[model samples]
Target: MNLYPINAGNFKLDGGAMFGVVPKSLWQRTNPADANNMIDIAARCLLIEYGNRLILIDTGMGDKQSDKFFGYYYLWGNDTIDKSLKKYGFHRHDITDVFMTHLHFDHCGGSIQWNKDRTGYEPAFKNARFWSNKDHWKWATQPNKREKASFLKENILPMEESGQLNFTGLPELDVLKNSALGFDIFFANGHTDKQMIPMINYNGKTICFMADLLPTAGHLPIPFVMGYDTRPLLTLDEKEKFLQMAVNNNYYLFLEHDAHNEIITVKNTEKGVRLQEVFNCNEVFNLI
Candidate 1:
C-alpha cells in the first residue's frame, strides 16, 4: 500500500474561531495571524493506493463557489487536487473512494463540481464512492442553525444525486477492523455528530488521520479545542482519550488543516500531550 499527501489548497480562517476561547497570545505563537486576524489553513487530503482501490480522504473546498462566497474564507495558493494528483501521476478518475471525515465545506466541498453545461452539479470524482457515516450524513444534511453555514448543499447533495454516495454503516462506538478499505474507522462526536477518523495501518505504522479531532500540532493541548466544535467539553474528553492512546501506541498523526506542518506525533509531557516531531508526508512515509 502507498499513501500520498494531496494538497487541495490553502485558505484563511479567523484565528479566534480556530482557537476558540484560547487567548490569541497563546495560539498566535504557533499559527500567526495576518493583519486581518485570519490564520493560514490547508485543505490537505490523503490518498491511499492499495490493490485496485485508490481512496481519497477529504476533498477540500472546491472552486465552485462564487467570488463573494469565497471571499469570506480568503482562499489562497495554487495547489489543487488536480495538480497534487498529477504530481503522483494520477487523476480524479483514479480515485475509487472518497472518505470524508466530515461534511464541512473545507473538508468535503471538492466532492462535486459544476457540470460541463453549467446546468447542474456532478460528482467530481466520477469513479469514486463518496464515504460518510450515516450519523454525519444526517447531521450535515439536516444541519442545525449554528452549523448550517459550514455544511453547504453544493458540496454534498450531488454525490447522492449521482448515485455514488455510500455509508460506512459503523455505529459511533464501533471500530471497523480490517475493512475492505484496509483501515479501522473511529468516530468522534464532539467536533460534529459522528465525525469519522480513519486509523490506517501502513508499513508497520499506525497513521491516524487527525481530521478536526486534532487540526494541528498546536491543538495537542486538550484545552485548545476549536470553537466550532458543538460540544467543547466532549471534545476535551475525546482529545484526552485519543491523545493518551496515540502517545502510548506512537501513532503518526496526519494533520488535515495545518498549513505548514504536515504530520506530527505527540508525547505525554508534564503539561499534557505536546508535539514531539513534525515531518512532511513523504519524509515520514517515503512515498517519493
Candidate 2:
C-alpha cells in the first residue's frame, strides 16, 4: 500500500477559534496570527493506494463556493486536488473510495462540484464510493444550527444523488468489526458526533489520520482543543486518551490540517506528550 499527501490548498481561520481558550501568547508561538488574528491552515487530504482501491480520505474545500463565501476564509496556495493527484500518476476518476472523516465543508466540499451546464451540482469523483458513518450522515443531512454552515447541501447530497454514497457500518460500537481495511475506528464526539479516526496498520507501524482531533503538531497538548469543537471539556479528555495511546504505541500522526507539518510522532515527556519528530510524506512512504 502507498499513501500520498494530497494538498488541496490553504485557507485562513481565526487562530482563537483554532486553539480554543488557549491564550494567543501560547499558540501564536507556533501558529503566528495575522493582523486580523487569522492563522493559515492547509486543507491536506490523504490518498491511500491499496490493491484495487484508491481511497481519498477527504476532499479539501472545493472551488464551487461563491467568491463572496470564499472571501471569509481567504483561500490561497497553488496546490490543488487534481494537481496533487497527478503528481502520483492518478486522477479523480482513479479514486475508488472517498473516506470522509466527517461532513464539514472544508473536509468534504471537494467531494462534489458544479456541473458544466451550471444547472446543478454533482459528485467530483465520478467513480468513487463516498463513505461516511450512518449516524454522521444523518446528522449532516439534518444539520444542527451551530453546524449548518459547515455542512453545506451542495457539498454533500450530490454523492447520494449520484448513487455513490455508502455507509461504513451500523453506527454502533462494533462498526469496525468486519472492516476490510486493517484499521480500527476511534470514535470521538467532542469535535462532532462520531468523528471516525482511522488507526491504520501498514508495514510494521501504525499511522493514524488525526483529522480534527489533533489538527497540527501544535495541538499535541491536551488542552489545545479547537474552540470550534462543540464540547471543549470532552475534547480535552479525548485528546488525553488518544495522545497517550499514540505515544505508547509510537504511532505516526498524519495531520490533516497543518499547513507545514506532514507527519509527526510524539514522546511521553515530563511535560506530557511532546512532538518527537516531523517527517515529509515521502520519508514515511519509505518507512512503510
Candidate 3:
C-alpha cells in the first residue's frame, strides 16, 4: 500500500481556543499567533492507495461556504485538494472511499461542493462512498447549540443525498472493522462523540491519523486540550492514555491541523509525556 499526504489547504484558528486553558506564554513559543490572535493550521488529509481502492481520510474546508462565513477562519494556502490529488495522478472520481474522521466543516467540507448553477449542494467525490459513524452522523445532523456552528449542513446532507454514505459503526472485536477501507477504527469520545481515528498498518509500522485528539506536536502535553471540546477533563484522560500507548509502540502520529509539524513521536519525560521527535511524512515513509 502507498500513502500520500494530501494538502487540502490551510486556515487560521484562534490560538487560545486551540490551546485551551494552556497559557499563551507556553503555546506561543511553538505556534505563534498573528495580530488577530489566529494561528495558521493545515487542513491536511491522507490519501491511501491500495488494491482497487483509493481511500481519502477527511476533506478539508471546501470553497462552497460564503465569504462572510470563511472570513471567520481566515483561510489561506497555495495547495488545494484537487492539486494534491493530481500530484499523485488521480482525481476525485478515482477515490473509492472518503473516511471522514468527523463531520466538522474543516474536516468534511470538501466532500461536498456546489451544484450546477451554484443553487444546491453535490458530492465532490461522485463515485466515492463517504464514510462516517452512525452515531456521529446522528450527532452532527442534530447538532447541539455549542457545536452547531461547526456542523454546516452544506458540508453534510449531500452524501446521503448522493446515495454514497456508509458507516463503520461500533464494530465488534475480532471483526475486520474497516475492511472496506483497510484500517482499524479507534473510537474516541473526548473530542466529539465516537470520532473515528483510522489506524493504518503499513510496512511494519502503524500510522495513526491523529485528528483532533493530538492536534499538533505542541499539544502533546496532557493539559493542552482544545477549548472547543465538550469535555476537557475527558480529553486529558484520553490523551494521557493514548500518548502512553503511542510512546510504547512507536506509532507515527499524522497530524491534521499542525502547519509545520506533520508527524511526531512521544516520549516519557520528567514533566510527563512529551514530543520525542518531529519529522515530515516522508521521513516515516522512508522508514517504511
- The residue pairs in collision within model 3 are none
lDDT of 2 at 127: 90
Candidate 2 local lDDT, 178-217, one digit each (tens): 3555467788889998888887777788878999999988
Once fitted onto the true fold, the runs of candidate 3 whose alpha carbons sit more than 4 angstroms away are 171-179, 286-288
Candidate maximizing lDDT: 1
> Per-residue alpha-carbon lDDT of model 3 for 139-168, expressed as tens digits?
999999989988998888989988999988
- Candidate 2 — which pairs collide? none
After TM-score superposition, the amount by which residue 36's alpha carbon in candidate 1 deviates from its true location, in angstroms, is 0.7
lDDT of 1 by residue, 104-211 (tens): 999998999999999999999999998897778999999999999999998889989899999887753646676557799878889899888899999889999999
Name the candidate that leads on TM-score.
Answer: 1
Between candidates 1 and 2, the one scoring higher on lDDT is 1
The Cα RMSD of model 1 versus the native structure comes to: 1.1
